[model samples]
Target chain A: MRKFIWTLVIVAVVAVFGGRAWYLHKQAEQNKDAIKIGVVVPLSGFDENMTDRIVTTLKTATEELTKKKPYKIQYLFEDGKYTVKDSISAFNKLKASNPSAYIVLGDLPAFGLRPLINETKMPTIVLVSGDSGLPAQSPYLFRMSLSSKDMIQRLASFTYNTKHISDAAIMKIKNNYGDDGSQFFKKYFADLGGKVIAEETFNVMDMDVRAQVEKVLATNPNMILVWGFGPGYTTTFNQLSELGYKGEIITDFGVFDKAVWENIHNKGDGIYFTTIDSQANKMNPQFLQNYTAKFGDKPDVVASFAYAAVEALLKTIENPKGIEAGLYELQNFETAIGKINYDKEGEPHAQIVIKQMQPDGTAKIVKE
Target chain B: MTYVLHQLIMISIYLILVYATNLVTGLGGLMTMAQAAFYGMGAYVYALVALNMPVGFVASCGISLLVAGLVAWILSKVVLRFRGETFVLATLAFQMIVFTILDNWEGVTGGSYGLSEIPRPSLFGWEVSTVPEYVLLSVIVAALITGVFWVMLNSPFGLSVRAVRDNERAAESLRISPQKQLSRAFVISSVLASLAGCLFASYVTYIDPTSFSLTESIFILCILLVGGSGNIIGPFLGVLFMILFPEGLRFLGLPDESAANLREIVYGTILIVLMYYRPNGFKGIYSVK
Candidate 1:
């Protein structure tokens, strides 16, 4: 009788724990109307600053959305750490950890997540540098940021059409992002009847770009086209200013961070960069006010893109047009980042705007 | 289900890595830091050849092994000249140089943007595409590697290497060439590292320079050190503890923003406690006399 009682006690204890686990798991499941958004971002590592802004803006967007939607919307964020392995690990973990309606990838490269996303078949909005072949690989994948090619063409057009600076030169970091921008700008500018006099490339961590700067200025081009990010970009500017080359400098929108630009603004005074238009700020005044009040400053382009991705994802989830079809039908959706439209390739069709940095570290839109 | 499989695959890959690391750092008593470099070389070589040619999995692995072995041999010449901390510093230089080559050699390695669309490993034309299939392949490969490692640890060559690790002069007195033994050990370690890298590249279908930074080398070393060196099982357990313990933190209900930091703290505390209470590690075989 004692042995039987002990066995019964063990079984009962196991049943209680198992039953509670099952109940918790069931509670986590959606009850016919809840939406889960899985956000993969670099919450740690080199890209943390950018993701910090994105997470704040994304939360604001989600909160604003919950009020307007009938369903209870929730977000589950995962840290990708800005590496391919970590990104995929985070994606897999997110899927297993929760039930997500869709995924939003912030500031991570698109190619690394392409295979995994194809496998998952989850509707994903990637807010990062775009790749032409990414969407085709995974039909459920959509991009919220402008492609490097698109931005380069816009920069080239503005410089040639408005500024009328014909002779141009190129110096870029020898990486994919830089290579894309440099190649496109060279071809487009050359096709527009401008001569690319000098083209030089540097490694990602090359601090002293004096040699490349000298080669670029040797051609005495009417303008210089540069490409890079972070300290490398700033280092190039420092070398150019020190070399006393006063030609109009052109680069991509990545150099638009006010904090980074503040110190190097005067070095490249006539510097111009191209990015997706800031009409989102114009259209969503309330969002801007709230974001500014919370963060004590305005959100950057990356943050705006992240916010747009969340808003678009939530809208799709609430109305439920199916995964691929719903994202496809999400055309001309107005968000904090202006009117958003995606081409058949899932590439954003947002207009590009060129802005000139002032001495005070503020950027003004170039009308032309 | 797939998530668990993914973690298992990752564990298998690191098992090979930590095994190779144990050969050099645990058994050989060398503190080289070029494991990530060799791993990257293997990944880049495999990805490039497979993408540009009609090579299958075996051929790609062979070529990657050859390239990694050659690099390891050349580095060993310089590394064998140093002792103690100097050896580590020299290998650190090698790691940085290899990383620079991978990052700047844009035409071949694809530079910072990384190489993607690497074909899945196919054996006799059977594609390993699904998570379950990949997991099985990884398990088989890991088992084969472990079997080889076991043979090596019990062999005459393994004994000689361990002798050199224990005492260079005494090993020489016993007619063992420390230079030759250390060199062989390093070359073998590099070969294993390359194999792991090839598997990772094929499995992930992407290769980038960021994955092979100095930080990664330190991480591999931490696995061996914390798991207790000088034994095969120690490294295996170390890899599992290092990989899975942190992963289990995901279920702790911590806020997302603080979870990553807290996980790090928890792992750091574990390491500290282990170092204090059981320096030889749970399944460790060697201890300071």
Candidate 2:
């Protein structure tokens, strides 16, 4: 009797799981007109809001692009679950979907799937990113995102050239991004004749970094390049108070999440960041208006690029011909983000922006 | 040649782990989920020592054994209560505790970025830098460990453990303390696990927390159970199946996006089928005693 009950339970569990998987497989086969572009993003994970904007912008841009074009660009969004394995799984699913090109839209964990991406022989593009440092390179991979190497060099140059900040301390998430960014900043900051007193790391999810901040405080840096992400950044200032380490907290565009500013501490004035998009840019008023009307909010760096991606794709396929025409036309198309100059590699060289936060939690571009 | 060598080294590592686990869960009436914690310790120790200290072959082996023994002693003391489900839960707590140390303790362990570019291991004026040489060393060590397990299991000490496992109350009445027997089995098992971990770390030339998780503990146990635990040749056969499943996944060659996940589904399905059809295992003694 016990054996029979156990057997029945196992069979029922298998039946349900098997049913769901089969339905998904069948759905893919039915969508014949759709050209599924696999989009691995962090929609429900730590970078949820950012990915939400990016995915939405991409969808909207695709619709707009399709209306202006002969063929429709269909995207299949896959949440990476904020993990390397899931990213690989998403890549595998895209390959299994028999898509034209599986896109590594955002999320640095996408590097973990580089080997599988390379094996697919399909073109893959990355947006503005910090490195996770898993795979060094792949033929199929093309990243227009400012590489860690480039970002650090530019940061060092900017820091040394400026007379405002003399001494800089470093605090980063204790991952590949932090490791590379820290090392890069350390080497270049010193090479550029800048003094870096201390380099420390905090767990990206750690709400309290008072211990590490105390040591960095003891160094008495004039400013701190406090590299962090997600909710961790909001807690950073709190940890600063506990440690009594008050200095300028400098960060990058990646940490400019909506959740960061929604909190009180993150809303503080004079918090400087180097990002790409300007929410109040008079030049791209149409973009700002349209994005706000649709998304009900201002788009961040990822949303702008993701929005640009769909815009680029639609404009590429403007004519009724084929992929060749789309490819050729995209070479000349302009996006609100910047010019879309896609090589055979599909890399778009876009301009990045630097913005500073106001006391009211709004970031205005620090005009050079 | 390198590929062949890699497989041999992999086989050796699995061999030691399987035997170690088999001794605990197979011969003794106790289950453990903290094997991966011990494995992680060995890897981290080797990574730190290789980077910082003068570590020779003997030194590496000694350190691995010492770390395992210490972890086992501490764990056994804490988890000796509640033998069935609670015991499983306790070891799970141990696994989580170890993971916390690895993930949160970044300053010392390098956290999630992992310790990379580990120095190649050398022994007695002979360095096994290449794949084939490492394979030879791994296989020789594996064979010796297996031989020791083989002898130990056949000894009177092994008989007492099995007696206690089969009937704990009866064995206790006969003067064999269940606690002491289980603890001894656990320590020996941990040593074997840690030794394999040391070799794995040295071979990969890196150590990370991701490599050792509670999932890994389940995987090692699956090998022994799927091959029919408690009897001779069970753990060995189980190890073969475990490696073969992944290699089979490689052959499917699904698309980039679906290949990895589909392979995982397939792997899980195989385990499920095996458990259903052959609960005693793929190669258990069929005597209806």
Best by lDDT: 1
- Clash tally, candidates in order: 1, 10
Give the poorly placed runs of model 1, Cα more than 4 Å off.
Answer: A1-33, A97-109, A130-133, A169-171, A196-222, A238-245, A262-270, A280-286, A318-320, B52-55, B124-126, B265-289
How far residue A18's Cα lies from its native spot in candidate 1, in Å, is 17
Per-residue lDDT of candidate 2, residues A317-356 (tens digit): 4446543335434654566566656555434445655677
Give the C-alpha miss distance for residue A280 in model 1, angstroms: 4.7
| Tens-digit per-residue lDDT, B120-222, candidate 1 | 9999978999889999999999999999999999899899999998999999999999999999999999999999999999999988898998989999988
Q: Which stretches of candidate 2 lie over 4 Å from their true place?
A: A1-30, A105-108, A132-136, A241-245, A264-267, A278-295, A311-333, A339-349, B1-33, B38-208, B211-289
Per residue, candidate 2 scores C-alpha lDDT tens digits across B1-289 of 3333555677788888888887878887567788788788787877777777776756876886898798798778878756877888998899888977886688878876667656667888889787678888889988998788888887877878888878889989999888888888888888888888888777766566766878788878778778876766877788878865664554443443454456667888988998889887888542111
Checking candidate 1 for backbone clashes, the offending pairs are: A280-A338
The most accurate candidate by TM-score is: 1
Which one is best on DockQ? Answer: 1
Question: CA lDDT of A30 in candidate 2?
Answer: 65
Worst 10 residues of 1 chain A by lDDT: A100-109
